[model samples]
Target: MIRDKSFYKFFVILVISLAFQNLLVYGVNLADNLMLGAYSEKALSGSALCNQIQFLLQMLVVGAGEGAVVLGSQYWGKKDLKPIPHIIGVTLRFGVGIAAILFVIVFVAPTQVLGILTNDQIVIAEGVKYLRIICFTYIIFTTTNILTASLRAVGIVAIGYLVSAATLCINICLNTCLIFGNFGFPELGIEGAAYATLVSRCVELLIVIFYLKYREHQLNLTLKKLLFIDTSYVKDYIRVSLPVLLNQAQWGIAQMIQTAILGHLGAAAIAANSIAVIVFQVISVAAYGAASAAGITVGKTIGENNIEKLHEIVHTLQIIFLGIGIISGTLIFLVSSPILEVYHISAEAKVLAKQFMCVLAVTTVGTAYQMACDNGIIRGGGDTSFSMKMNLISMWGIIVPLSAIAAFVIKTPPVVVFALLKSDQIYKILPVVIHLRKWNWVKKVTRAEI
Candidate 1:
């Protein structure tokens, strides 16, 4: 019980720090969407569609960062700081390579990707312009993610929150000036949002690079480190990262499919669903950040072979997430209407968003549970294979099919489809609960001959 209390105290701090970090990411997103919607309704939908491609790319980058956290936490536990450079180098190399390829696709074939998301000519034109302006931002954004993830792995979570705050401020200032034609800047409209994002990302990259130079011990980036390709370390990184990458791809594609389904309902549904998702993500990232912190802390503990405290820590983290989930979800439900007003969507769309948010509010606990157990506890324990398999079954086998049935066979409303899509979270809880209780996840993964 004493151990539980101690863990809870630490977890509370983690949650608070993560809330600030998420404030930066989500705050920028909120302001970006509002500025787009307020300036031009078409821009809102267009940016929404363009962001689908960007979102998939981001998932890949974030997955690499996640892999970085997994390795860095365990490596830090073992006091193996020597290999930190190699790990960062390998992750960044692979990430940058992938981002280059994606950038080509976005630049060379922007319309082709937009076509997959929508058929509206106006949306397609705006989305194409948005993609063209923002494609270069991927390189900068990917680097920021890798650097931030490496820092977090070394217990520098506060820096990430600070960076996020800085990014939010820069993004807002640039967006306002560029979007609204302030300070004699041409009113670039929707395209201005893209340019603002691009400029802000560059600034974020510069900050991260400057910080890395000053704090070289925390980050081990060097010319030789970047040039020297260690096959063995690369192999280990791939072994753990591939499944996670696949999991993210599967989850992201499934979401795109769900979005396409919502698209068929009407433009209003698309706009409303997009608005609601951004709002919910702001709330959700708090829990997400906490879970990320938990995974790192737990992985560090297991690295030291402190097996006795594992279960207590996991339980405490789970409880912390539960309380956050409940309270946050309830607030979301109560203020759903006011929140909807922030978006200039239709009245019908607002109603649908409110109902969908209510359902999301009720399911937050389940979502939080999965984040702590599956994402933090299991993956932190080096059970990546199991985590991948579970997401495959839950997202692909259950959620996709159910969403399709709701959309096609039942011809349900978008709200109903959105609700059905959330079933994966509910269905996933049982396996996570069973897995957590077994305590097999307590073993140290660093000694597994990586």
Candidate 2:
């Protein structure tokens, strides 16, 4: 919203970085499934179920990161780094605590944890093995994600992608080596994927720490500073962050429930959905990039008090988002048929995948707008409470119930149920457009802080 040509450069850089970040993370999941599918369809379904639970944690980490981004980005945008350390401290406190609890639960009751997701015995057995091995990643992910989001808040956007790229390379190499017993390693099968993820996460944390240390002065961050906290700053950060945390936490749990519902239909449905989800992520990478850039753009605009730029930025972003949604959705539709022939999956799963993909292609249009407005424009502008309500109203108020009814009560087709699960994307479209026109989010969140 700063309208300077340089602002566009920053936006483009952040978008590309965020897109790549999502790709690297989700690409790892896709790769794991591909490799495991080659091992066995049961292994693929089993690991995918485990990853869904892991995805919930990832969303929690992202929630904490979003809070840090909302506060830290706004403060940094105002050229005052006073609140950054305290915000990180508070976010990590919650994130680390959640990670610890999840670890304990998964460690102590691996069967129960995996059991909640699936009913198939073979998939459940593999999922239990995967869960036990991967639970350690929760805490690692908590710390790493907080740092990544916090760094991005302060204009170190590309660093996250660099770190993810390196980590992914390690993950891929490890997966190939351990999963298949290459390089004289034992064939660990599905469990090998978990080991690879754990090792890569550890390496990722170390890399993030070293990078932050090297640039600490430039970003005004330090170990002591990260460890320290100011009560007033804590309160301020909490006030602005609670809604964001709730938004993601609630949204994540709902998504997990949706996944569980799919899982219950049998391993075949779960496997099909997993493949479809991977394809959706691959095609929708640009939307993620755009959403990430939107947040930074809005936060910078508010921090800099560039009110005149609001109308122009909002209108232009909406146009760009519309195009992104349409283009990505088309890409998904175009590739689904060809992709099925290549992936190692059954005829039944392939048929279901095609059905699920058609739904994804259409729903992605609404999803693009929802992400752009809610994540980018609204949350970035410090309108997190508004976005939270929209998220809850759309998902809980609409999608969840519809999905439940479609999947259980009416016992509809898997594709119909999938469409119902995605209804929130459609529900959010017009509301976001209406809200953007009002310009309520244009107010500066950093005015009082500075």
Candidate 3:
């Protein structure tokens, strides 16, 4: 315990910092949801659907950043920060490329994508308008995410928190003007939300560029590095990132499948489930923040060849995540109803959300273990394959199948389907928790060229 104190301290501070970051990011969407609901219920529903599609687009950026964490943390740990800038450049380029692809898909084919989520003509029409308007912003937002993530990987936590808070304020202000046509602005309603988001993202991208050019010290991302791709570094980046990319993609696909299944049940189920998820995500960000810091800390230890200390840090982080689980879970359980009340859904949806939130509350510990092991330990050590395998098995092997069977085959309601889905966390817990005890996560993984 004494030896682990520093690790816990680091995790606690990281979690607190990241919690605010998550609040800023997710808080914007939540506030948008509430504001839209207050002004127009139909607009809120349309925006919710568009938000789901946006989440899917953002996943690619997330995958790329996660890969960067694996490489950046280990390299930074080894005291080789020279390659850090190149890594950032490479990751940002990939983010931009993916964002471009998603933009075309969402803009040129908004109806096609929106159709996949739902068949409601009203929802799809509104979603299409929102998607087409916001798709162009993805390139900017995704690029910002990679740069911001890389910055955090190298101990620049305060910047992300500060920038995100500022972004949130800017977004809200824009939302007020655009959403209600204040001060000579046109009233766009749901489209206003998309416009506000795009403006905020542009601001975020500008801030990132300013820091990267003058204020930043991590990378020297010139046009040559950004455009003239080094084949070797690109190959290695793909090689190291493949497993992580697959892991995130597969997990995302499974989640969409779950959502599809719930969609078939009806709109109320979908809305309630969605609300519960976003709220749960708010708390889960705490665990993710701990995992982020732990991954960097452990990767640095491995790069420096401090195997014993790496082992100690892993153990310490796992414990801290567990404690967070207990506290976050208890808090969610106590506040589930009040939180659900914020949504403008029907009484049935409210009750279902409460039940869903309750089940999720209990499973927070399992989530902590998986995140710490998979993100903080395995991927931190650049052991991406095992992390991929664990997630694939937990998501595909356990969660999706079981939930499908329970919900569709057994004719279960939203409550039971949610319980089945939450069971995935429990399955992921045992194997990862056991693996954490082995202390095999002490290895260096980085090319000198980086």
Candidate 4:
């Protein structure tokens, strides 16, 4: 639908950079999974459980950042730079608050928290070891994410990937030295993985700080701007960002519940689910990236008041989303066996992991399209409430209840439960399509005078 070569050029470059950055981020997790799987299944399972807590923090932090982008991009489109620093400031406040609260909860009751996920005492012990060390990174990760998100809104995305690349390399090297006790380092096992991640997060934060202080010229963001924000934007921010925050919180809790259901099944299900999830995340980075790109594009377009071209732009993006979905799903199917061979898990775990990946492969087609359509286009256009409503109805009202019953009452196989848990990805397409046709998602979230 789009005949403009420039649009394609910009979209391709942005999506690739965002996707590669996301890939590097998940690559850190892949490294941890691979190293710990080789060490022991208990260690792998523990770290994965602990990572769920981390994932919840990430969802909150990302929600705050996405809120900033939803507002900041429109300002950027209008070439209004003054409001952005304030938006970042507001976002950072929420990010730090969420991180601090999570750190406290985890630190106080590590075992109690992990216990909710699984019944294995050995897994709980290992998870405690990892959680103790990794909890320190929560605030650090949140700060880095918010800062980088501010940069991303204004089209400075390359630095994010660069920082992730540094984090990935550092994480791998440290993991190699600590996990196996190579090069005179202590063999901390799961603890070593946690330490590696902590160090990498510190390094990532440092890099972003240096870039914002020196290289970034757009906003010239400094401590003063970050600390001294315009309080007037708080109401505006809360109005637009609350739904996104709640949506993320809802989704994060749902994921933990899903994990709990499978965890109660057995250790094998937990380990297999972990492996399958990491692979799916690694493979679907491009799809997620496309969503991020869509958010920025849609938000900026709305900000510019370029309503006439919106339909063409969105249509083109949908086509691209479908293409990315097909390719990513096929790749997941093809690479499942070879990737499974790298893990040193049991035969039962490997088989379940493969089946889980196949289900993800099919659902990914829906995910790529619907995620971009809803999270990217709709939410990005300032209808954050719509996503909250959609997720509430689809995930909580339908998927979670059904999946819980299947896992608990029906006592279905793990694969069937997993498929049910993911079916929302497919069925969500109908509502998203219907919603897109109505054209009510377009709204200018920016202010007339800031």
Q: Write the per-residue lDDT of candidate 3 for residues 10-41, one digit (tens) a residue.
A: 76787778677877888778768766766654
Clashing pairs in 4: none
Candidate 2: tens digits of C-alpha lDDT, residues 211-305: 88875565666778777777566676667778888888898788778888899887879999999988998789899889988888888777877
RMSDs, each prediction?
1.9, 1.7, 2.3, 0.8
The lDDT of each candidate is: 0.78, 0.83, 0.74, 0.93
Q: What is the TM-score of each candidate against the true structure?
A: 0.95, 0.96, 0.92, 0.99
Highest TM-score model number: 4
Per-residue alpha-carbon lDDT of model 1 for 1-450, expressed as tens digits?
Answer: 335566666767776787788777878878888888777667887888877777888788877877777888888888776666777788898788888998998899998887777767787798888899999898888888887887777777776777778888888888889889999989988888898888888878877777777765655576676578565678778877787778877777777777777766766676777777777888787778778878888888877778778767776677777887887687778878777666666677778878888888877768877876787888888777777788888777778888888888989877788888886667788888898888776655453644
User: Which candidate model has the greater TM-score, 2 or 3?
Assistant: 2
Q: In candidate 4, which residue ranges exceed 4 Å CA deviation?
A: none
Off by over 4 Å in 2: 1-4, 447-449
- In terms of lDDT, which candidate is stronger, 1 or 2? 2
Q: Select the stronger candidate by TM-score from 1 and 3.
A: 1
What lDDT tens digits, residue by residue, belong to model 4 across residues 99-183?
A: 9999999999999999999998988999999999999999999999999987889999989999999999999999999999999
Candidate 4 has an lDDT of 0.93
Q: Rank the candidates by TM-score, best first.
A: 4, 2, 1, 3
